[model samples]
Target: MKNIISTIAFLFITINLISQENNQMKLGDKIGEFSALDDQGNVWKSTSAKSDFLVVYFYPAAMTGGCTKQACAYRDDKASFDELGVTVIGISGDEVKNLKYFKDSYQLNFPLLSDNEGTISKIFGVPANKGGEITREIDGENFLLVRSITTPRWTFILNKERKVIYKNAEVNAVEDSKNVKEIIKNYSK
Candidate 1:
């Protein structure tokens, strides 16, 4: 009985590890279709994007220092990205309400997806942890922002074929947009 129990435990562990490994995406991997709610409460579908390239960037949280910088950088580079035939999307565990506030605060022009359940992050193999909350003053009132999970900054670019062409696990928040733009430019050449 003891031996049988041990074998069962080993099998369970192995299966779990294998499943996790399968979810971790790599370059050249074809991304499966996904959809989530955008900050404006609209359903954004992967298959609906008509751009030549798709930029999917995951940030830890909304209204944070590093995340704000990364998002703003992307915002500032919107024109360049549009010119390159790229559609940039930022995903975070924040709720749609929080995402709306963040977008409005920064005047961000791109779509921000709310991945409150971490399902999207898991699909992209981005590391995620427990959710957190922070308070911020937007005028004269303090608003509490909550998240369901926190993901490390990661970026992936998919070509028109829906295959990942670039993956950056260790991303520099301030330089991420610039780096991705250059990468895409060079790739086009």
Candidate 2:
């Protein structure tokens, strides 16, 4: 009986393990090759995206403090990021409704993709379990897993040819803008 219980618990953990940031993406690596649905439920093949620069950021949850600040910072810096030929994108597991609230709350003007199915999360390798802030009761026992990986708080920069020009995967929000700007300054044509 103990083994049966352990097996079930382990299965849960394993399945949920998909969300963490695997970052198959590497510096100077080509743009993503997979397709994902946009906020409007429209299918987008990354190949169809036309931009001199692209900034794809993955975050953990919507409406949360840290996530909100990072997203809003990106939102507030649209012009500068744009002036440098950059397009910003955000991915998260938050449901569509919640995302709408968040976008409205900040009056953000960018595409926010919903990874509720976690396919995009797996592609970007953003940790599925974002610490123990969320909990579930199973068989009257509360199960908790540390996520602490929400959004992985990283950014990717791709040139017109879809080759990565700047990669900032370990930046802190307070200094992320500086780092992104620096990348643009150093690499812009």
lDDT of 2 by residue, 43-73 (tens): 6566665767777777777666677788888
Judged by TM-score, which candidate is best? 1
TM-score of each: 0.90, 0.71
- Please name the candidate that would achieve the greatest lDDT relative to the true structure: 1
For model 1, the superposed segments whose C-alpha errors exceed 4 Å read 1-18
Quote the RMSD, in angstroms, for model 2. Answer: 7.6
- Candidate 1 structure quality by residue, lDDT tens digits, 82-117: 999999999999999899999999999999999989
State each model's CA lDDT, in order: 0.93, 0.67
Count the clashes in each prediction: 0, 20
Per-residue error at 9 for model 2, in Å? 9.7
**Looking at model 1, which ten-residue stretch has the lowest summed lDDT?**
15-24
